[model samples]
Target: MELLELPLDEHLEAVEKAIGEWTEQQKRRCKSAQRTSSVEVAKSEEELRELQKQKLELLEAIKQAEVAREQQKRRIAANENETRDLQAEIMKAEPIITSLKSRENLHQGNLGNLNQESNKSAQAHAQVVDELMKGISLYQKLGLLIDKKRENNLAFIFTQLDPNNPNREFSFSLRIEDNPDVFLVENCVPEVSDVNELLDQLNKTGNISTFVRAMRLRFKNLV
Candidate 1:
């Protein structure tokens, strides 16, 4: 049993079998490593695809946000323009409003003055009417007095007596010319035979009372 160990051929065959088993084990290991590497590459490719999709979605969102911002800016600008226009219109109207207020005040003052003047004129007209009434009353009284003094056949006329006709029995007239306070007194006597002589005497005397006295002396019963 201890003969130099097995024969030389038996030793060589054993060594060859061990070497073949080791080589087959190494080949299986290399194939497993290659499969693992392929799976990792596939996972990495899937992650890259997801990243690309997310980037596209983010780009779209950003674009929409930019468009909305532009629209908002335009609206703000339009509002600012409208506000400026309103302010300009108000500035233009300010002076006209002030002038209208001033004119209204002036018109009110003029109306007040006109009312006061109208009241004064009405009062003055009433006073003038009262004076005219008083004058008419006095004229009637004088007419009645002259009527009482006249004789039965010789009548004394006060109104509308003709100064040119000396044939009338007795005529007296009061006439007011341009002046309301001053009057002219005219009298005619028919008893005086000569009308021209009586006119001459009246002109010379220039006094109505003297002419009346002379007429009374000439005719005792004449009025």
Candidate 2:
């Protein structure tokens, strides 16, 4: 009976040793799996943080874009307002601009007319000067002295009447008041007998120089 008990005790000790080794192996495996799970969880947390950072950056970009769009819309609206104002101003000033253009054209026309009238006046003045020069030359050549007392009155003196009477002068005055074709003679130096007949011839011929020459000849005959 002692020998059978000793063998049974040794078998029981062996069985207990086997069970403890298996439990130790299971504990080591569980610890390794927990370490791996912890590593995976850390990696997942880092990826989540990266995704959140990216989302924040995207949101900021969208916000900036929205602000830029708002600013652009405001600028566009302001430009439209300015354009409308400019159009209104142009509409208001259209009539004034047209009136100014018309006035400028009228002023140019008036200047043109004034230039033409000045040219005509210069031409008439030149003609009158030429006629006056001709009359002065004719009087000088005929040895006649004419003095204008008024617009229609004149005094005439014949200087070269007779060679013997060198100092003798035949003077007369002619006046025209009412009639342009008729002349009144007065202030005769020599009392001519055919003075009325000479005046009739002068009225018929309308030649004052011929009448003066005839009077001079008549005075020479008397001398």
All models, RMSD in angstroms = 20.3, 15.5
CA lDDT, every prediction?
0.56, 0.77
User: Which segments of model 1 are wrong by more than 4 Å?
Assistant: 1-16, 92-223
Q: Clashes in each model (backbone N, CA, C under 3 Å)? A: 0, 0
Report the error of model 2 at residue 34, Å: 2.1
- lDDT per residue (tens digit) for residues 122-163 in model 1: 564444334433434453443312332321111234332234
Judging by TM-score against the true structure, name the best candidate. Answer: 2
lDDT of 1: 0.56
lDDT by residue (1-223, candidate 2, tens digit) is 9999998999988888888888888888889888988999999999999999999999999999999999999999999999999999999999999999999999999999988876775565455434544555575555677777665567777776667766578777876534244667888888788988999897786666677667777766777
Clashing pairs in 2: none
Give the least accurate 10-residue stretch of model 2, judged by summed lDDT. 124-133
Model 2: residues with Cα > 4 Å off, grouped in runs: 1-14, 107-223
TM-score of predicted model 2?
A: 0.44
TM-scores vs. true structure, each candidate = 0.35, 0.44
